[model samples]
Target chain A: MRKKILIVDDVDINRDLLRAILEEDYTVVEADNGKKALEIIYSMKEELAAVLLDLIMPEMDGFQVLEELNRRREIIGRVPVLIISGEASVEVENKCLELGISDFIGKPFNNMVVKKRVRNVVNFFDSKNLLEEKVAEQTAILREANITLKAQAEQLKKRNQEIIDLLGTVVEYRNLESGEHIQRVKGYTKILAECFMREYPEYSLTQDKINIIVSASALHDIGKITIPDSILQKPGKLTKDEYEYMKSHTTKGCELLDAIKSEWDEEYKKVSYEIIRHHHERYDGRGYPDGLSGEAIPIPAQLVSVADVYDALVNERCYKDAYSPDEAFKMITEGQCGVFSPKLMECFRKVRGDFEGLAAR
Target chain B: MNLKECYASIGADYESVFLRMGSDSVICKFLFRYFDRNEYNGLEKAICEKRWKDAFIYAHNMKGFALNMSLTRLAGASSVLCEALRNGQPEDGVSGMLADVKSAYVITEKAVGNLERE
Candidate 1:
């Protein structure tokens, strides 16, 4: 197809002269003034290859046309404009250049120079548009790659959680605890953490933090593996010294967890470490290992401590028969096993029925 | 005389016009007719009405046409007239420049008529 060139001049003779010169190689579209030229420029902006503009005209002048084109830079950016003026002073040419004209053609339109300049400017823009398309295509590809990388990372995270859950089950198997123990602990931690978040906004427990606490709750007794099988599986109660030695499981679990590292998320690892080391710590600062006081123990460990003790009371073990959910709830709230935070006791009271439901399962 | 002889006699560069216009006599005839019908009268009317901007437009148009046809002498006269009106020259000075343009237009018109006969 012939590339269209718009010839803008008020004088019919000037338009004809340009058309006669350019009409052979290009499709010449004529506008008698700047106003009409602007109309054509907008309507045929996509098809137009270049514009040959006269500096002086009725209604709107070349400068005005250039100003409007500058305002709509996208149009002028694609369609090159060459000023065709009888005025052709250096001042006028420089002014058009400042207005962002592609080229300048003096009147009496040199047959060769006009055609060549128009062709050159048009070719330059065509290549520029092609480069822009290529860049856009590459950007889209990069965006797709980024999305795939994000999905793969998400899949890897799910797999890592599975490995950690299996490892928790192994620890339970070795200690002669059922797989349901970990499940019950996780469920209880979630319920308590959620209630804590709602009842006390100061904790700032976002859903992500709750999820980490839940996952980390599974490994709270991971240190129990370090205790001797004689103590872990003993049918009778431990002697005072033996009980004191068994209490070191909290700190021993922290050391075992700290020794090994993997590619798991750092926040999850940190929550796991806190739960392992301080889940036995009492709210009144009387607990073993750290003897951390109220609010001094990390909230994750505090919540896990409640879940661990409640599960142990409501579920059967070698040393004790299982207590009813009501009896277990009363014992924990009445400070039968250890002193817990008042706020946690409130949350536990609210979800006591839910805990009973889990016990039934 | 033939169009070429007539063009040469009046100092119009006929060969350049022939080459530039692709030897299309119809386009040549149209341009000549346009020049004859309007060139002098348009400037005369603008000057008579004291429309200096209109006068500059007409004079500039004439200069462009004359330059395209390689009528350098007429183009030079029209360009001078255009510049005078453009710079807001005194009425007497503009009138003198307009006279020079009119004299050149008359000679160019006669030559165009002679070529049209061929």
Candidate 2:
């Protein structure tokens, strides 16, 4: 590739002289003053590789032009500038260097020196372009790797979600719940989580987190698999020891998940285990094996806890009568039943009608 | 490396890229989300009971996560169990591999957790 050089000089003879020396090997562009040079530079962009600037030009001086070029360094990158001056001084030369001029050509210069200096800066321009080419190639490669990695991640996310769906179906079937119970709970949880997030946007819980909550909520009762079918599908209230055994389902669910921990993600692992282990926990510290109370229990568990109780109370079950929405709400919000956070209770009160609407769907 | 040094080495663009990559990396997200104290407790109980089928499932599941994280050795160990179970091999050498997997998970888990916190 032939690099195009732009020569900006007010003096016609000097411009002609420089162009005559450079034109054979290089494609030369001419500008009478700094302003004209800048116009060409802006329009030319990547094609113009170097500039032969005259220090004493009308309108915009070479130093002013240099400052402007420096300002646009990001777009221009490392283009070489060789200043052509008739009156040379050490201080002026030093100032040019400090201001990042590539080279200098003094007055009455040897024709060979002009050729050599132009060629030197042209070499600089070529090397810079080469380096930039390498960087662009590397960036392209990195971009391809990133895209591959992202696709792999997306595939895994889809597969994990499938596992969650399959597990939810399996557990619900084993527990003798309705086919749509787990699916409905998932839907309800999503709506509630979104509503909660909207009500508290300052927390910055992303939509991703909300989706996880919905997907993982389906597996809340997986520990019931570890319980005996007779106990799991029992039609009547259990004996004290049997209830104690059933209470161990939280730990049992955690154990079952642990068996698959090697395959699961830590976030899903935590949220899933908490949903299983602590969904039975009461906000007032009165429910379950651990009896973790209030915010002490993980928030995922609390969310599931409310969802679980509300659904269990309203939906027809093998051992219990389905309560009306009013009755269920009254029971959950009794002054001291030792269930649910007050703040969450307030949210439930606001959203129970919406919950019923979702359940009906 | 110290925080600033590691940050520098990764580039000023590191956080944006790291977070973008981490979210886009299933293994990283899985490690951060699923493998936790509760999982440890569950696996301990399952192993103590010698529930081989359950062990095989856990090991294989861990293998999936390890492979995704590019924790090759951990993935290899879990893979050993996964293959054993897939081929219906008895759980004879699983304990050794499980131990290797446990250590790897701990190290990666802590390192990743620190990065996330930072």
Candidate 3:
């Protein structure tokens, strides 16, 4: 399609001369003065390819028109302006160039020069717009690819968690503990961690922290895999030396996890390491392995400690019958198995009914 | 005399005008006639009223038209009158420039009439 050009001149003969020169290659629009030209520019901004503007006019002159165009940033770059003036001087040309005109054509129009400059500028803007469109298209494609990559990473992460849980159950089966033991511990940790997040803003137990604690709970007893079968599966209470061998499970579990020769998310690895190494640490600095006191224990491990003891007490094992949820809860609260943080005990008290419901199920 | 002789007598470049307008005598005649009907009367009224700005506008417009038509004498005289009015020259100096413009316009008109008769 032929592009549109606006001819702005106060004199009919001048406008006619420019129209005669340009109308062959373009659709010409005429305005008698700057004010009328501005009106046309406003209404036909998108259609116009260039403006052939005369400097001297009544109402608003060429300089005023250029100023208006400069003020409207959206219109200025989009439409190229060619100044046609009788008073063409170096000063006028410089001023128009500073105002961002595309080209200048003096009065007594040259047929060839006007046509060529107008065509050249219009084609230049056309190519510029095409480049911008291509860039926008490429950006959208990159954004789509980034979203797909994130989803695939999430899928790979879920697959990795499944493999880790399968390895954990292998260790549970060797000790004659039900696979449900890990599942119940994960569930109870989530309950306690979520309650703490809601009731105590200072604990900063965000949802991400709760997820890590739950995932890490399944690996808390992973060290038992390295303990001798005789010690792990004995039908009676452990001897002192056997208990010492049993206590090595915490440190050994950390070693086993550290020994895994594969890449993983650093956050998951850190959370799992904390839970496996410190879940047995006592709140009062008396429990085995590290005797970590109060907040010295990582919050993830502390949460898992309460969950592991509660699940162990309420679930059946090869060595003992399952205690009722009420008995398990009393033991944990009364500090029978080990002393827990008072804040964690408070969270446990709020969700003890939910725990009984899960055990019953 | 022919239009060329009359144009030469008035110090106008008839050959260049003919060439620039693509030898279109009808267009040349039309523009000269348009100026006679529209611009000349407005310029006379403006000069009579001593409205220098209005007189300058008329003179500037006539200067551009005369230049395009290759009427060098008329274009040059109008340009002088335009500058004199624009620069706020004394009344006697502006009137003298206006007289030169008027004489040039009369010669240009007679030259156009000669072309029309041909």
Best candidate (score: TM-score): 1
**lDDT tens digits, residues A84-156, model 1?**
8777789999999999998988755557677778888989988987798899999999999999999998887
Could you tally the backbone clashes for each prediction? 0, 16, 0
User: lDDT tens digits, residues A14-34, model 2?
Assistant: 566677668877899999888
lDDT of 2 by residue, B1-118 (tens): 3333333432223343233233334323444565553344444456668665565555554554444334555556556655655433555766676676676566555555555432
Candidate 3 per-residue lDDT, tens place, B1-118, comes to 5657766878877777666566555445545656567577788898888776777777877887777777789888988887677654434577788788888887778666666443
lDDT of 3 by residue, A274-327 (tens): 998899998999876888898999889999999989988988766788999999
What is the TM-score of each candidate's chain B when compared with the real chain B? 0.83, 0.62, 0.81
Candidate 3, B-chain TM: 0.81
Each candidate's fnat, listed in order, reads: 0.34, 0.00, 0.09
**Which window of ten consecutive residues has the lowest lDDT sum in model 1 chain A?**
A106-115
Question: What TM-score does structure 2 among the candidates reach?
Answer: 0.58
Span of ten consecutive residues with least summed lDDT in model 3 chain A? A106-115
The CAPRI classification for model 1 reads as acceptable
Best candidate (score: lDDT):
1
True-contact fraction for model 1? 0.34
Decreasing DockQ order of the candidates = 1, 3, 2
Candidate 3 segments whose C-alpha is farther than 4 A from its true place: A140-361, B1-7, B14-22, B25-30, B50-53, B85-92, B116-118
The total number of steric clashes, by the backbone 3 Å criterion, in model 3 comes to 0
